[model samples]
Target: MSESVAGREAGSGIPARRLWLATTLILLIFVLLLAAYLLLRKPTEVTVPAPVAAVPAPDPAFATRVRQLEELNRSLEAEIARLGRDPSPLACPPGTARRAEARPPQTPAIA
Candidate 1:
């Protein structure tokens, strides 16, 4: 074995056994502090809200608002039915070409 590794001082001058003891003491102290903290700490109180009833009471205006919305929906459906198929492309303002009218060059069909 090498003299440095086998020597009592191990070159740092502090004995190897003393260093090992110091490390073990520090670890023991840390564990004791942790255990004390866990045992002495106060537990928090948890609050749970009461459960809601299965059926909630309806609002006074709920029925009237629903009836009014149904009537409006029916009227809109009738208006759409009256305007059958929309007339082909509404007129584009003077200078602009209609999108349907603008065509890309057609390629000749192969025999």
Candidate 2:
């Protein structure tokens, strides 16, 4: 096997290792040139305006709901004041599970 391997060399005194080194250097040079070209290319930059702040108007339905709530609140206060005279009968939201005297927790109990 050694005798056959000896003839594998060109006998130019240059080793097979030198061929591998030359191939590596050639590839390295090509990579460097590609990287240099990419680095030197012009780059673009963009500027965008900051968004303006604006006051938001209440939604139509929301405004209507607010008015309805105010009316309902006033009516409720009046009813309470009227009912304040007689403590016997009570009023409650329709479909409430319990009796009117059994007032549901409006402001949650402080823990």
**For model 2, what is the error of residue 1's alpha carbon versus the real structure, in angstroms, after optimal superposition?**
11
Write one digit per residue (lDDT tens) for candidate 1, span 43-87.
Answer: 999999999878868776998899999999999999788766554
Best by TM-score: 1
Q: 15-111 in candidate 2: lDDT tens per residue?
A: 6678989999999999999999899988888899999999798799999999999999999999999888876555555676685589666986798
Best-fitting candidate, scored by lDDT: 2
How far out, in Å, is residue 22 in model 2?
2.5
lDDT of 2 at 21: 90
Residue runs of model 2 more than 4 Å from their true location after superposition: 1-15, 45-59, 66-111
Instruction: State TM-scores per candidate.
Output: 0.37, 0.34
Q: List the residue pairs that clash in candidate 1.
A: none
